[model samples]
Target: MNPSRPAPLTRVDGSPVRVLVVDDEANLSDLLRMALQNEGWDARTAANGQEALNLVREFAPDLVVLDIMMPGIDGMEVLRRLRSTGNDVPVLFLTAKDAVEDRIAGISAGGDDYLTKPFNLEEVVVRLRGMARRHVAAAAAAETRLRVGDLTLDEETYEVVRGGIPIKLTAKEFDLLRYLMQNQRRVLSRSQILDQVWSYDFGGTSSVVEIYISYLRKKIDSLGEALIHTVRGVGYTIKSAE
Candidate 1:
């Protein structure tokens, strides 16, 4: 374990994150299991595809660190079976197959991310942490609507309302406002907003960000208690007064 590597999360909820490491190599499986346990997770190991599937049913892990090549029922097949049954558990593939096509195949077959063999332990830990974070965030984002005090944004209908009044916004303004609301209370710099709202190739300046932010404020904050706030010289943050 590298000293400078980021630490794994303590847990998502009250219980530690559960991980199932599936690989035919006992040494590799053992190493990963020990490492994950050290990171304060409930880590289990599966020697082959059959064992991996069994654990998938029994352990119901939060993450599956799987291998591609195995003697029987291979990693890809196991993943396919899991997906076929509507299991969307996050999986990180550990494989020697580093080619682009192999990666595509793994991803197309439902792997979340892949790490080539001879991987750095720190890299594995970082990827696992990132995957965990994304899994948690995505689950939260699947909500149909978001509310902050009197303001409400419906994801399915693309509607915004404040204090029982409907608010209309342009497509760009809606996107920007949605981003801000999703990450409510987190100050987002102009560059970050541009990248997310306008995408990476918008070729716009910071002034554009300022203009749209003002537009959102007028629509969203004009009627009700202000939710959009500017952190002078830093960026913008949105939080409900309630």
Candidate 2:
């Protein structure tokens, strides 16, 4: 019998991993994009730091390949702004300088990893996979109590409450809610929800995500201004009602 293939790495919401490749060199960015796409990941390229910053919001990449030396904003300043704004997306720095100080500065500026120039593309892919895995694992492990507005979920006690009213949920429902709460305002594709909350081995389809989302809405949204929301043509998100 053949061994089953491993599940692909994904965002907490189960979407294809997104990567932003930022470098002044167009050729290098193009090459990186091709490599990432070959790995079944989405990749976007930015010519400079400013463009990189813009794409971060528009693309919402899970990881960033930032060039430390840029004409304007530079990688360090870019990393600083991202960190300051509470954006903890993992970053890998690319630098032409091989000095110890250069590597240290990149790390000090909040880069998760750094690669010197003329590095191997294969190595880049390996490091990025590692970072993506670590980041996802860290996000899953770091939170116990997730809150959005007045709604809260306690991972330890498996309790869910909204506006001080306790809500009961089945085990699957609880897992679904926890995944959504963990992702907060981020739109979670049905496929993402299915993969993370219910395994393919569980003999379920993406429709199960929709059904449970409906269940969650009836139980939780019915109590308040509706934290559970549907993003048309995309998926769902749990956000504070405006």
Residue-wise lDDT of candidate 1 within 1-242, one digit each (tens)? 88896665644355778899999899999999888888878999999999999999999888999999999899999999999999999999999989999999999898999999989988897799788778767655657687778888888899988888999988898889899988999999998998898988887575899999888887777797789999999999999766
Model 2 agreement with the true structure over 1-242: per-residue lDDT tens digits? 23583566877767789999999999999999999987778899999989999999899889999998999999999999999999999999999999999899889888899999999999999999999899888766656678999988999889998889999999999999999988889999887887898875768553788789899999998987988889999999999955
Which residue pairs in model 1 clash with each other? none
In model 1, what lDDT does residue 100 have? 93
Q: What is the lDDT of residue 179 in candidate 1?
A: 94
lDDT of 1 at 113: 93
- For model 2 the local lDDT of residue 177 reads 92
Best by TM-score: 2
